[model samples]
Target chain A: LAKTTQPISMDSYEGQEVNITCSHNNIATNDYITWYQQFPSQGPRFIIQGYKTKVTNEVASLFIPADRKSSTLSLPRVSLSDTAVYYCLVGETSSGGSYIPTFGRGTSLIVHP
Target chain B: DTAVSQTPKYLVTQMGNDKSIKCEQNLGHDTMYWYKQDSKKFLKIMFSYNNKELIINETVPNRFSPKSPDKAHLNLHINSLELGDSAVYFCASSPPTSGNTIYFGEGSWLTVV
Candidate 1:
């Protein structure tokens, strides 16, 4: 599995845009970058995923540059409820095999009102 | 309906006791996983099973045993639990190919006194 690096913590005010970046310099060829959001007492929820370029959903947007060495998750107009730990994972897909993606200490985003 | 459901949302037991956390997913997924989240809120994968077969087994303790009766259910049994075992255990499931977007159940908080 490819290891990922992200900020330990970030702070953002309500109605502001927050971007959390993750670096995976040794990302594999078939690796896809995915992000998950975890609240205090709840399970982690899938936020966004991308292989390259940009992928947007109703909740967040994922931007991956051409190098694919890093990706960023952008949350627009954040609210206090959006404060959660965001995990960045790089999925390693081998030739017709199952692989489990590893999770690191995610970026804890604190959205303050 | 809850896609993934775990029984006994909170469990408190003394050290050297044995306990099990039952999990069931109604999403018709073929793969399920067990993860442990520590007090510092770092999520770690313990084990994974696909179609009733063990696939991913991390460096978890031998006291932690996972059993999958079928694809939709995975139960974790911990024997002779210790104080360090007091943490939130989460059950998750996902499609075989869509490994990036895993659905996690509300965790089972275990307190080993």
Candidate 2:
């Protein structure tokens, strides 16, 4: 398990791009970084995940540097509905083929009008 | 058709009482997890079960017991609930491999009165 550090909160306006960075200095060789988004009364939804370099999905893009010590989650053209808490997790596959990701305090992104 | 669902969306119980939150995932995932989100909104992994076997158990108290009857069902039972136990409990499931996306259920809000 790797510990991750991220900003406590961020502010973004609608139609703007929002980027939240996470630092995982002790990331393992086999670890993968994943980002999740949680709304007020709903469960956290998977946004994007990447092992290295970059990976993009319909919702967001994840950028991991070559060193793998940090990663960034980019959400484009944000809307008020995108205002939520974002979590970054780093975990590796265990022998049983299961990964128990550790969650941090997460970054609260407020998308304003 | 929600992939993951938990019963009793909100539970209001008294101290020393016992309560249970049932969860089922129809995503055909092999691993299920229980996570706790405190009032301060810090999410922590409580337990993880893979194919009905306990895979990860954090330092949570014994009063919080998790039972996985099968690959698709995991239930949490809390005994002698205390005020400190008031928080949102989320049920989630993921594939057996690492770096896969995990689906979460709408949390079960437990209020210990």
Candidate 3:
């Protein structure tokens, strides 16, 4: 499995754009970078994912470079509710032929008023 | 309808006891997973099941057993629960079409006292 590195924490104000970057230098060929948002006392929710380039959804956007070694999740117009831990995961196949999701330490984003 | 749902959203059990967290997904996904989030806020993959078969079993202890009775249900049973077992356990599922995208349940907060 590919290991990802990201900021431990980030602080932003409401209505601002927040970008969280993740680095996975040893990403495999079939690896796909995905991001998830987790709120306090709740489960993590899927925010966005992309193989390469950019993929946008109503909640967030994902940008991956050509190398696929790194990816970024961009959340526009941040609000206090956006304050949560954001996880960056690189998916890979396991020996049992199932996709294993190993979540590492994520970036905790704190949106201020 | 909830894409992924977990029962007993909060569980407060005594140590040396056994408990189970039940999960169900209506998304018709073929894969399900169980993850543990400790107080430090690190989410770790405990197990994964594909089509009712155990696939990815992480370094978790044998006390943590994941059972998949069908394609849409994955239940986690923890035996002789210790204080370390007190954390948030999340259940997730992903469709066959995407290996990286997953939907998560509200989570089961287990407090071992």
Report the number of the highest-DockQ candidate. Answer: 2
What are the Cα lDDT values of the candidates? Answer: 0.89, 0.91, 0.89
Question: Over 4 Å off in model 2, which ranges?
Answer: A92-98
Which tens-of-lDDT digit does each residue in A27-101 have in candidate 3? 878767889888888888888878899999999999999999899899999999999999998866677666677
**Best-to-worst ranking by lDDT:** 2, 1, 3
Q: Which residue pairs come into collision in candidate 3?
A: none
Cα-based TM-score, every candidate: 0.95, 0.95, 0.94
Model 2 chain B weakest lDDT span, ten residues long:
B94-103
Report the C-alpha lDDT of model 1 over B1-113, residue by residue, as the tens digit: 99999988999999999999999999999889999999988888888899999888887999999999989899999999999999999999988664358999999999999
For candidate 2, lDDT tens digit of each residue in B1-113? 99999999999999999999999999999999999998777999889998999998877999999999899999999999999999999999998667788899999999999
Against the native chain B, each candidate's TM-score is 0.97, 0.98, 0.96
Q: In candidate 2, what are the lDDT values of residues A17-107, reduced to their tens digit?
A: 9999999998888878889999998889888889999999889998999999999999999999999999998874446555668876899
- Ranking of all predicted structures according to DockQ, beginning with the best and ending with the worst: 2, 3, 1
The TM-score between candidate 3 and the true structure equals 0.94
Which of candidates 2 and 3 reaches a greater DockQ?
2
